[model samples]
Target: MTDVQTDTTLCDPQDMAGRLHTALSDLVRDCKARMLRPRPGHQPTADLSGFRLGITWLAQQRQMDSMLDLAEQLVREAPALVGGHGRKPETLDQLRACMVPVLRALPEVNRPPAQRLEWLFGTLLVDELQCLPHAEVMAVLERNAFQPRHWQYIVPYLEQNLPKVKGTGLSWQGQERRRRLLGYAWQACQKAGWADRAEALFRRELSVCACYGELAELLVHRGDVEEAQTVLLKGIAKYNASRPELTMGWLDRLESLNGVG
Candidate 1:
């Protein structure tokens, strides 16, 4: 019941690679020129037309070395281009818009895997943090799988930012972002073997959001089955009228935990 389309024409990989390199080289040149000399009253722009498609095509062709070479050029040049204007929000926003394709491609291109972590924590999260929003920065983290060695960097950044996000004004959307950030903080603490900090963060999140199902899951994870059951029962009662689907899901989880399913 499915239809498929196939291409039968043959294309030269070398020609494709040459064109991709030429495009990236042009981008790097344009970025450097703009950074070195800025025009008054005009925002600098880099045309990223076909950039992502080029990178994706090269990656699909399994030309990793070529992709890495292009990525490193962008990584080295981007900070200078983005930060050349000294963090003026408008200028930074303009620069970030130009660099998004490069940023999104870097994680896929860096070799040895750990190199990606280094670029992410040491460069993007630290130096380029000013140009990026927390959500965009977190997107990079969400995309990549990191190891225990990353805990040293990840935990500190999460700890530092959690309070700042918490201190934002009382808006529903802001509070929602805070809850999501708190979840990351809690997970980072737990992964770093800081069980007490993790537990405290979980409780703090519960107090803020009153997402009792999550609290119950945490308690169940720590072997507090009776407490978890109590929490889930409370969740089911609270949401049963307003959020029947969520209540049913929590009921299923509770029953499974109690060996009732």
Candidate 2:
């Protein structure tokens, strides 16, 4: 009888680690080469979904160290991979995919808070509005506590993206996502004791989307009762025909403001 050879390499942790590293390195090289030498009118694409799958596999294998290593490498390479001149919509989508996993994993990874914050602000949040969608990025922020330094990025991001929410030819779904993100941004600003910024954001959103109910609530919170009443009236008039439910809700609030109910 011929002796049977069992393949032990697949089960060896050390070998698996080496293989993972090699695979990731090769992926990075391929992505970088594509970025460096782009075909005309062809946007370079990163296999972000595949990359996320690999990260998930690493997590399933309980390879925490390898996951962190991959996160670090991704953060370091992110700007180069998706940034610079002639960025197309496709590139932003790729950036969003690449950063989503990194943002989710960084909090759990054993890293210094300062270093993580540096990565968050310096690398990820730099021109974040361009690279990330309001909803996905805000979901990550909602999960984490707001740091004071976060205001610097958060303010500018809100300012830039809120206007795009309305009259930008977005679908209803797109508008809804931006509206949800706006709500989260308002709450975050309030939590961070940036009431002024929160009010500003509400006003900015109102200018773009006529978010009267939201802005009126904020105004009432800040003791601007008269303005709140005016806003509610405007909302009642604007939405009464098309959005009866919303108008009814605003009417209730207005009645309360007037001590009528």
Off by over 4 Å in 1: 1-51, 54-149, 163-183, 259-261
Best by TM-score: 2
What local distance difference test score does each model get? 0.56, 0.59
Residues 147-245 of candidate 2 have per-residue lDDT tens digits of 666654555665665554432324444444455556666765775678888887876666455578888888888888998899899878876997696
Supply the TM-score for candidate 1. Answer: 0.43
Candidate 2: give the clashing pairs.
none
Question: Residue by residue across 183-238, what tens digits does model 1's lDDT show?
Answer: 55656666666756666665665545556676776677778888888888887887
* Model 2, position 228: C-alpha lDDT score: 89
Please report how far candidate 1 places residue 195 from its true position, in Å.
Answer: 2.7
The C-alpha TM-scores of every prediction are 0.43, 0.50
